[model samples]
Target: MIKKYLSATLVGLSLLAASSSSSAKVIDFEDINFSPSGGFSGQDLTQRYGLNFTGGRYGFSTLTATSYSGWGAHSGNNYAWGDGYNMGIEISGNNITLNSFWVRGALMADDVGSITVRAFKGSKAVASKEFSYTETYHLETFNFAGIDRILITSRGSGPVLLDDIDVGFASPVPEPASYAMLLGGLGLLMLAARRRKSS
Candidate 1:
């Protein structure tokens, strides 16, 4: 009996996870503009900044930017940083979430720094993280209420492209034990139906 209940609960959880509020829907890409400055890349930071379909360094919308793969010096920390693109979004609603995702490099660096996703509440830094360095990409999610602005930045050095900047509402669902309790209550319906048939 417990096995059946657990299976049912898992199915319901998966269903909720696949729902609308659970996923970050793409609103727009705006457009990728060139930013030679404000990055850690070399060659006077001369690299295309706008999003391109063929070579996308960052993919949140239709547009994405590719970076210049070079061992560059990062600002302040002087850490080696890769050349990635910067994306800005207008935050609204009661709550907001920033899901950080990275594209793994085919040729991973020995001393790869880290990718940093910065959460900005109207130009104010709230939270940040250093993503791992490898050929496999990873995703990180954060939750906030009444957010106004957001910015994502890279921490490590070299060239890496990021895609799928998911910013949207996070859905709330009933807990598994709650689900079990609800399902247990549903058994009463079967009892009622049998009574009526016997009568």
Candidate 2:
């Protein structure tokens, strides 16, 4: 019975260590405090979202009864507008791994024609993609590791629609003492099993 309990404890400890190492999160742009009425823009979105930004203004489709799906604004304005003529989200000091975001052409504005999305580690570009939007919005997944910033440039037009930015960060690394404890527990379990076999 003691050996069984020891083995279970070791397994639980392993799982706990793994789960405490990294976290995945999503920013759906649904936390804005706007009433969702007529056209709204010219605000610091990075500040609004508690992030960092460098570029043109960010806005949203005026609040309306009939609009994008799954939005919590006055109406259903689910899209965050970026006069993405030239824009980028800089996540310095806050080391993160950008996962993905949804992008579409800004309605009635300028179709987001072609655009280039790039992920960078400092001044070095790690990943990039040049794609054009169709009639519907698409989720562009970025699989870069330890990226500090992301930039979006309009290849053709100047406006773009964006939503649901996903990012992840590695949790603090465990201290050496944690490893010692884990190994010590396992060693005891092994010793117990060996003694049982001898008996």
Candidate 3:
């Protein structure tokens, strides 16, 4: 009986470690960008509120409620002013969790607009948030189970930027009891497998 139990325990530990190892890790990925083709010009004297992504291009671009003067198709199309031109990304993971990430944003007027953010896990809405324009340089954190997608939104006139996005398991991650149970289950399964093999 002791031999069976020991074999079971080891198997469980191995499985627990394997699953734990696969959790999403934090890394620097392309957060947002504002393409230069749209009057960015990359000029020194150009608009200071330029949207530069991690890759320096316009994939997953960002916009704010605050509009810029002499920008976009017309003056009204400026990045701010709640013209509704914004960008976002989709992120999710398996057996993993997500916490708050950082964002860069500011308001030209006191009437900063509203912010809308949505998160998903395999086509399911896992989380969402909307903040008033009063917040600046907001570092929003979120925790989720088996995360799989991320969504960000903004409205009105503000200049918002996002970068250095980090994703990982929750603090005090891999709860002790959860690990214990996982390891125990694996150990029992292994013992059964070995017994079947011997037979």
Q: Each prediction's Cα RMSD? A: 12.1, 5.9, 10.8
Residue-level lDDT tens digits of model 3 in 8-37: 677767765666453345433222234445
| lDDT leader | 2
- Using Cα atoms with residue i matched to residue i, what is each candidate's TM-score against the true structure? 0.37, 0.65, 0.47
Candidate 3: what lDDT?
0.47
Candidate 3 shows a clash count of 28
lDDT for model 1: 0.42
Better of 1 and 3 by lDDT: 3
Off by over 4 Å in 1: 1-23, 26-96, 106-111, 169-199
Error of 2 at 137 (Å): 1.6
* Residue 151, candidate 1: C-alpha displacement in angstroms: 2.7
lDDT of each: 0.42, 0.60, 0.47
lDDT of 2 by residue, 128-184 (tens): 888886335788887777777777766545456666677787766778787788778
Question: Where does model 3 exceed 4 Å of error?
Answer: 1-18, 21-24, 28-59, 62-87, 92-96, 106-111, 133-135, 169-199
Ranking by lDDT: 2, 3, 1
Backbone clashes in model 2, listed as residue pairs: 36-63, 37-63
| Shift in Å, residue 66, candidate 3 | 19
Q: Who wins the TM-score comparison?
A: 2
Task: For candidate 1, write residues 1-199 as lDDT tens digits.
Answer: 5465567656765665565354455322223344434442222122222111221233322222234344221211122123443322222333466554334432345435455555556667777655655544444555544354444444444445344445556555556776576556555645565678789
